[model samples]
Target: MSKIGVEQSLTNVQDALRAKGYDIVELKQESDAQNVDCCVVTGLDSNVLGEQTTSIKGSVIEANGLTADEVCQQVEQKLRH
Candidate 1:
């Protein structure tokens, strides 16, 4: 079970990912991403991620403008690689 950190502003994608068995964590601050394998975000909001936006440890997924299914697909692919 991989953990995914989602920017707080992008909560819409959380439910969809959670159903897929990914452990979702709300990324309110940099510390929240410590244990996550990937960070899903909407590129529209840089401030929402603080400094973590630029230097995320794992893959940084830009899900903005994508549907929930699209977002899930992107996340799924990232986890695979």
Candidate 2:
């Protein structure tokens, strides 16, 4: 299973992903996302500083208006490629 970094506040998403056998890493600090295959954020502070930087090589999924199932589907789709 691929490793997934998720925001601490998103308990629902974490549980759902874990149920699907994904390795979920609770994102507490920036370093926690270091080796994750994908990251799920709340999108509350995405690009807030208007600065572009690459911290991880994997894709980032914004869990703003989507349900846990939808986010999981997106993760699966991204991993397929």
What tens digits encode model 1's per-residue C-alpha lDDT throughout 1-81? 989998877777998999898899998877787878898888887666577444656788888789888988988888888
**TM per prediction:** 0.86, 0.90
Error of 1 at 61 (Å): 0.5
Ten residues in a row with the worst lDDT in model 2? 46-55
Instruction: Report the CA-based lDDT of candidate 1 relative to the real structure.
Output: 0.83
Q: What are the lDDT scores of the predictions, listed in order?
A: 0.83, 0.88
State the lDDT at 58 in candidate 1. 78
Superposed by TM-score, candidate 1 places the C-alpha of residue 57 at a distance from the truth, in angstroms, of 3.0
- The sequence of per-residue lDDT tens digits that candidate 2 reaches over residues 1-81 is 999999888999999999999999998877778899999988998752234664887889999999999999999998998
Compute the lDDT for candidate 2: 0.88
